[model samples]
Target: MEELMRQQQLSNGQKSERQELTCSVLFTNPKFRADKSSTKDEINSIARMVSNAEDLELDRVFRKVSKNDVEETRSLNRSLFEFGHNFEDADGWLKLEQPCKDQLATVLRYMFESHLKTTVQIEINNMYFNCHFIVLQVYSRFFSELDMIPLLVTLPENAVSQKAFMLSYKWMLSDEPVLELAHLVEVYVAATYLRITSLEAHCWKYFDDEECYNEDTACALYVESKDNPAMDVVRNLMLTRIRKFLLTFVATKEFLDLPTSHLIYLLDSDEICVNTEIELFDGWVTIGTRGKRTFGV
Candidate 1:
């Protein structure tokens, strides 16, 4: 009984040590990923070597692989390889920012107007944008399946608003980029629905920091975000600002001019930091005195 307990304690200590140790693995080979190279056999050999390593438990070897038929798809395929090691952190990566203005603008313009042999159709609210699959796939994973269907047509009927879609499409091709503050929420909703992550991030950053916050913008965002779940992040940001500065927010012309629904929405929020309910009631009367009876609150 004493021996068994001692063995059990030893095993538990080993597990505790293992849990504290971080593990990471990376594999990079310049020639192995070449088209003519035997990558499959190479990966198998590497897996066996890793599994047999003294420091690596055979059961802990993780096998992850991805392959695409380059001959059929005309796209380079690759796999993920692993070897056991503990790595809490590491830093050796370069950040490159290359801005191509004229080159991209010229190509986009040509692609928009040119009669390309291979093209994909993107339809939004009865408006059609016929574009090169190559260019489209670069910016959107949503169009990556074009390798199989060269002439596929995709519609953003329920996903994107018409105005938002048009605006995003135009902004992508514009030589001088322009996205209005008023259309930020709409564009963000459309971008999120389409899974355009970069555009989604850009729109969110704009709303979170770029634009000046006011009652009208907040109310407009509230109205536009009614049925959309993706807009919740930006909506909450606006609500937080409005709540934190309720007194100053109410003093603005935009607040008094708010529609009934928006006012009610603000009043309904428990998070609003008002001194008393009576203060809000007094403001409501002031709005009423301005003859904006449409403001129900």
Candidate 2:
């Protein structure tokens, strides 16, 4: 009986060890599997987000690079055409300095005066100009359409004066062109007729200066440009100036010399101010009397 009891106790201990092993496997297996699956899903989500962000960043970089490349190409093309004296650097590349650039422009102007490689003859107001087709094409849209080589281009009579054309030509060749106030009006008119938009815009900027105009100049400019639709901006600016000094202007020789229509136009503006109605009426009568005297009416 003691032997039987020992065998039974040994069998009971084996059963308890097997039960503990089964319980540990059942509890740990499910938790480990769940943890691995959840970790893998989270890693995949983060990786996808990181990839999208990288794509966006790369796209932005590419667009910026493309824009810079286009701008650099345009700048290079302009530099190729611009007059510059090139000196080889230590690295065997060419570079330019301000003095060298000025010297180059001077040389080119001398060549132009010497009539070297002149491809076209431009006639304006009985004056003739020997010009390079390429140079004219660069400055004027009107010249660009004339594809024929060794041509003679004649401008309409009274379209632009000889002095104005010369000034415009100088402006085209110059690296830095100054529009003197004395010659500004004629040059602006010449640029308009030539279809040189850049020079036209440059001349317009001078009118913004208050010192560029006064009662006399304003009246002259108004009469000079009133008929030109392209010069309407300058015409209107002069009109505004005239109105602002209307009382003082009417006493000036310019107002008395104004055409009958221009005098009426100024007197008709609502913006015109006077100290009294009688003063305004008196100014009008004075202009009318001058007009009648001039015309012997």
Candidate 3:
């Protein structure tokens, strides 16, 4: 009877150990078996609307958004996509689609028509933007930090133009005008700097090699993004295209305007299309002389 009891005790211990192992396995990789709930998927889908790279880059350039703010922003955007025209669900949670758009349009119309009811003055590179604080604040976290009355803010060097800012505002209010190709670069830089995730993503499609291949345009974009470490990827992409079109690039105003160091760096590239040292020297002289004449030096 003692021997039988000992075997039963050993079996019970093994059974407990097996139970522990099973529990550990179940909890080890929760994501692999996470609940297949629609709520979780809904939040995740909006979270992925803006890519990690773009979000991180925006935060690096602009100030970082709080975790709560980030979640709220994503939720708000999801609401817009899921339900247009500012409709609310049974839970009474509001989506800000048409309401914000209508508000913005009214405010802009008022401001432009010289009504001057509730406008804030924002300064960017000697240009003044008299706009409704609420409207501007609604779309950009950068604007939200302003201390209210007639707020003045200055953007960094080579930031957005007045047109780009207005266009971005329009896009935020209503997805209209459809992201004009002519204003893409300025709008992209502005959206990124202002941490406007939607506008940034919208403008991103214009940066692909096929659309941005022109030598002057590519070189100009390359120079503009070179200063910001967050924009290194964009700068490198432009550089690649510039090298691809080296022959045409050498004669362009953009190439002429490059600092001597950059010009020398380009001259060193084996991929440059010049057939001989003489041709290379001629190209160099042409760029330098054109730069001098253009600048009236």
Candidate 4:
């Protein structure tokens, strides 16, 4: 019945000429070629409409409507995706102090990725992050200082035990373009957290070759979940990403036995020299003996 309703709405939506007007400047498809000024005005109008709607759990409630009207659906998607980051200062990350920058790094590496799992894949490709890679570099700088899970300081309160994540939902003014990208960026980062965590939960112990092992025990029931086809596809994709991430740190044997954190520890034992990249990023620290009791301090 829900599918039928969506189809019915789409038919009516096609007949509505008003649906053709659009506010998207990034894509210039046949249906959305409104003039720049007109598009900006329309986006502003929508922003004002939603600015103080203040309905609790608004996105969930809105999803309940299940409209097939394409433009209405899309306009709402764009608005919800752009809500936060509006209040950030003109030079938000650029002008931040070192401590604040450090905090932001923790937020990105751990906090942000854990937040957006609902809408994003666990492993995101370079396609999207390219636009905002600058912020990511900043994230690498400040929070990247630890060899261990900086998770102690970075865990969102909600994530410690609850279903929620700590995310800044600060609403933005109507003008800046990055505001449009903020929520999407949040989604991307949150997905990264889930992907990394999945690796920790499922494959951290085996130091050999996880793929070779997964292949060896291909028929084992514990490795493969239930009989749903869609679920199987998803599981396969996730495993594929996990493999790639592991390859980066995983020596053929090292990857099969331990998780990423343990592996890093194994390689960065006390006698290790300070690599140039580490100094440049200032993301990693060593403690005890050579790395003895040393960190960004």
Candidate-wise lDDT, in order: 0.63, 0.70, 0.64, 0.34
- Candidate 2 residue lDDT tens string, 48-70: 64755443333223321244465
List the candidates' TM-scores in order.
0.46, 0.54, 0.43, 0.14
RMSD of each: 30.5, 22.2, 30.1, 34.6
> Which one wins by TM-score: 3 or 4?
3
Please list all clashing residue pairs in model 3, or write none if there are none.
none
lDDT of 4 by residue, 133-158 (tens): 22222333322343543212333321
Select the stronger candidate by TM-score from 1 and 4: 1
Ranking by lDDT: 2, 3, 1, 4
- Model 1 clash tally? 0
| Alpha-carbon runs more than 4 Å astray in model 4 | 1-216, 221-223, 233-297
Q: What is the model-wide C-alpha lDDT for candidate 2?
A: 0.70
